[model samples]
Target: MQRLYARARRAWDRPLTAYYLVLGGSLLLTALGLVMVFSASQIEALQSGLPSTYFFQKQLVAAALGALLMLAASRMPVKLHRACAYPLLAASVFLLCLVQVPGIGHAVNGNQNWIQLGGPFQLQPSEFAKLGLVLWGADLLARKGEKRLLTQWKHMLVPLVPVAFMLLGLIMLGGDMGTAIILTAILFGLLWLLGAPTRLFATTLAVAATLGFLLIKSSPNRMARLGCLGATDPGPEDQCWQAVHGIYALASGGWFGSGLGASVEKWGQLPEPHTDFIFAVTGEELGLAGTLSVLALFAALGYAGIRVAGRTEDPFVRYAAGGVTTWITAQAVVNIGAVLGLLPIAGVPLPLFSYGGSALLPTMFAIGLLIAFARSDPAARAALDMRQPVFGRMRAGVRRKTMRRRAERPPSGER
Candidate 1:
């Protein structure tokens, strides 16, 4: 057992461990998401007079596209990522602005944050903005130097805070407080990675809390959601309906679950069985084991992301990994928290597990960015290079065999 443990330790210590960890976790989550989405959406799709596989087909297509994007990003050179930072940020800002164009932007569920891009297709700029912020912040800080940002608070806060707020304002204008909160998380996560002063963090936290209170108080729906705290049963018909159903779904599933595609809540009881509340459906259908596995995979992904950041010497890679890690993990926490009734419903989709094309695309790309960072580690690059097949190995083996045969001849005279 000790020998096996030592072997496992050695394997885990490899430079490529971070890369494999991220890949494995992301793929598992994506696959599981497909299964859950299909199961949860079956009844809804059929009720809409569409094929039973309508939502599943759409989700599968999105997943395929996302996988291609992820692969492209993963193979991209780190320098290329840095080079594209400004352009990507600029484009994201333009899209965010364009989303506010009257008649051009589309509204859904009180949030006018999406733009219709032809039939049955909509694009969410806020999702792209998350990626943009991470890249732009990392590039800016990496250029200024991580040490300067750490020592000088002014250097850290200057344009970053203002730009972040501007983005937040744009998102909030569209009534998407959820996306705004996530953007804030990315900004602060980057700041924290740079070792911002504790006082600064505290100040920011207080301000954010105050602002969040104001935002929540301004919306009746948000207030109702906040009121769901410590509720045994949903009060009004439309008040805590989603939250209550989510809990009911979870409670209905014991240890092994009711089996896949057998979730009672997804039939009609639970709203958004495949999106924001998908975790609850997962619990109902696959049980405690499914939910725990999802959490474990996310934890592994987070560890891999942090490991990549820590092992890298490049400031850009470090900051980017840190920001991406925080973005994915924070959003996951919010999504899961809402489903578990621990927090107000934030309408944020679970990373790699939700039924939204817009969310999945950028998230997969971000995971790819993490993979790129892991691959860029010098030791990891060397190890991967050594794995490539080489015809020279065959020639070297032949040369060694000849040399051994000659040596076995017992010298020039003895042969």
Candidate 2:
């Protein structure tokens, strides 16, 4: 057993290990999400007089688009990503503001965070804002390090806190406490990664807690959800119905599960089975084994991301990887915790496993950014080139194409 463990550790120490781990874990989660979405949505689709595959088909389409974006992002140069940081941030802020337009912004479940594109199509600016904030914060902090300015708490918080408040203010204006919470988590993670002073963090934490309390207290819906926390019996209160049913869904699945497409709660009892509560659907259909597998995959992804952050020499890579890791891992914790009744239902989607296009696209793209960072590692790049000779050939082919194009062009003004 000791030898086996040693061998495994040695293998994991390889350069491309993090890359493969992230790729494998992401693919697995996406595949599981597709299956679970189908299982959880079939009953609801039929009840709505639509084809049983309706929701599943939509999810599959979104996954396909996300995959394409992921691929493109992975191949992009790291500098390009950094260069686009401010622009992405600006666009996110603009979109968030646009979602407040009375005629353009669409409300669903009391959250006016969606901008209508067309019938049955809406874009959630908050989702993309998470990515923008990650990129922008990472770049900003990395720049601070270049000037030796990260030592002081003031330098660290200067633009970050104010900008974070701006984003949070916009999200709150739209009544999306869930997205706001996740955004706050991202900012906290970035600051922590930047090594903010202990006193600063303590003060920030207290203020954050106070603000969180105020936000929740201000919302009757939020308060009602919180009231379900220690309920012995939910007793048919609409607020607790979803929470109670989520627990029931998980309970119904014992060791192995009720089997795919066999969840009773998804048939009618559980709400948002395909979205915020997909984890419960996963448990109900695939059981304890499935949920554990999902957990393991997320754990692997988190480990790989942290490894990239630690091993990289680039400050930007370190900051970006750390921020992205925190965002996804923290979001997953919020999601799974709510499903398991360990935390208040925050209405946050499971990172890659939830059935929402807005969340999935940026998430997959973020994974791609991680891949780009992993590839930036010299050893990883060497390993990839060695493993895939076609990449070298493609580089050569591109050079040849450029040379040929130059040669084919008419001389000076001869054309």
Candidate 3:
């Protein structure tokens, strides 16, 4: 346990600035989650004759445990993350495969993507897959960059794209479209940061957009959602009910919100209050002001990730940090967008803010990686070197003493 704690502290101690960024982001999100969960779940529990704070209590435990894991991960170096990437990727893939097995995996809302871990907590393998794929992709790209993929895409990217698609294909089998899209965004972001071929990325983006349209349109349930956007009367239990309720929650909040835990929509009117639609509850109880605050928090996270990526010279560190950062930020955007009715719902949870052990722990661990890379930066070392006043004074004194002795000495012949 001592060893474990030391390792985790290394990530935080690596760079004070990086540590602060992660700390701020983590604390803000956790605090915001606590508030929103309570606001969203209060009415939900009353409607169902359960404890009003049931969801909040569970989320608090998960967040606390997740923080512990994050600290442990932060102590590791980038080399450690790179070395473990492959094994982690393989493990996540295996778990995802297990989730597909009958009787082993549990089905929820038409998608059989969750595995019952024999507890109140269920494991979402795709969440782990997102983290694994990011690290693995980063490792691959770092190797390519080492071999000068900075100038050679044909040899590097051809191999890279397939691995990405393979992971996406496996995830899509669960019909987890939101996770797939988030993974794709991370992949593209990493590739872009690694300087992958521009034409390839743009072309792939176009193709992806087309495929996403086809996927959504193929399902009548999803198609109805798109059609209901313009319809005033979507009926009582139609496609628009969820989205319309979400919108009403936001509008009801007005500016300052209806005070904490006073949301009326969470009274079974809005669906998935503790899951994908958590953002709707935020808007409903905390109002537009609160929703924007959440957005700003994610914006800060993206900034930190970008800064870390830019600070590191190691390709592996850059890609891994950037990939993970992109993954979380992108997921946050998609979740918020879905709640705002700007996008069709695809059942993506709100990263740290959502009540899921799987998403929370892995995400916190990834942030730990970001801090590790940021702390190990070349500039940080230089700054530390400059701060050692004792060493600087010692060297300065030595130079002056030598100059004084030389001045007092006779010519070289006398010496």
Candidate 4:
């Protein structure tokens, strides 16, 4: 057992481990999410007079586009990414502001945070705002750190906190408390990575908590969501209808589950089965084993992200990776916690596991950011360089064989 443990540690310490974990874990979660979305959404789509595969098809297309974006991001240099920070933030802020305009902005499920984009499609700028904040905030802190200005409390909180608040205020203006909470998490995450003083951190946390409490209290809907925590019975008007149904779906799947596409709750009982409560549907269809597997995949991805952040020499890489990790981790925890009745329903989709194109696209790009950082490590870069020739030789051999076969073969028309 000791030898086994030692071997595992050595393998984990390899230069390429973080890269492989991010790549493999993200792919698996996305693929599984596609499968679950197809399963969970069929009934809802059919009831809406659309094809059973409608949602799945849209998600598939988004995944394809996201893959291209991921590929492009992974190949970009650190300097290039840093250069893109301000532009991306500007675009995010612009789109987010656009969502507030009448006739242009749209609402879904009571959240006015979308812009209609022609037939059967919409844009959620808040999702991209999360990515923008990660990159922009990282760059901001990295610059300050280089100048040794972070030691002062004012410098630490000045522009970063204010910009984050501006974004949060915009998000909250659309009544998207869930997204605002996530943005707040990303801000604190950046500050934490910078090693802010304990008193400052605590004071900031208290202020955020007070504001959050006020926000939640002012909205009856938000209050109702909070009241549903650990609820065993659906409240008045079935206020906990979605929450209760989610629990029932999870409970019905004892160990292995009812099998994929066989969930009863998704047939109209549970709300947002393909978006918010998809984890419950996953439990109902794939069982506890499937749920645990999903959790493990997220854990692996989060761990790999932390490793990339911790092992990096560049302050930008460290802060950006840490911020991304915090965003995804916080969103996932809030989402999964709501499904399990451990916390209030925040209406945030699970990272990479929920069926929203807006959410998936930015997340995949963030995963690619981690991949880029992992590859930037000196040891990992060297390892990759050593393997390039092997791949090149394999490609060369394949081309030669293909050409030889072509020369020896008869024309297709003759055949």
Worst 10 residues of 1 by lDDT: 146-155
lDDT of 4 by residue, 39-72 (tens): 9999999999999999999999999999988898
lDDT by residue (tens digit), candidate 1, 210-255: 9989999999888988999756687857588899999999999999
Candidate 4 similarity to native, TM-score:
0.97
Ranking by lDDT: 4, 1, 2, 3
RMSD (CA, Å), each prediction: 7.0, 6.9, 12.4, 1.8
Clash list (residue pairs), candidate 3: 7-75, 8-75, 11-74, 11-75
TM-score of each: 0.92, 0.92, 0.84, 0.97
Which model, 1 or 2, shows the larger TM-score?
Answer: 2
Count of backbone collisions in candidate 3:
4
Instruction: Identify the runs in model 3 with alpha carbons over 4 angstroms from their true place.
Output: 1-18, 46-50, 229-237, 381-415
Candidate 3 on 242-357: residue-level lDDT in tens? 87788888889999789787888888888989788998888877888988888888887887788788777788888887898889888988888777778777689998897777
Candidate 4, which ten residues in sequence have the lowest lDDT sum? 227-236
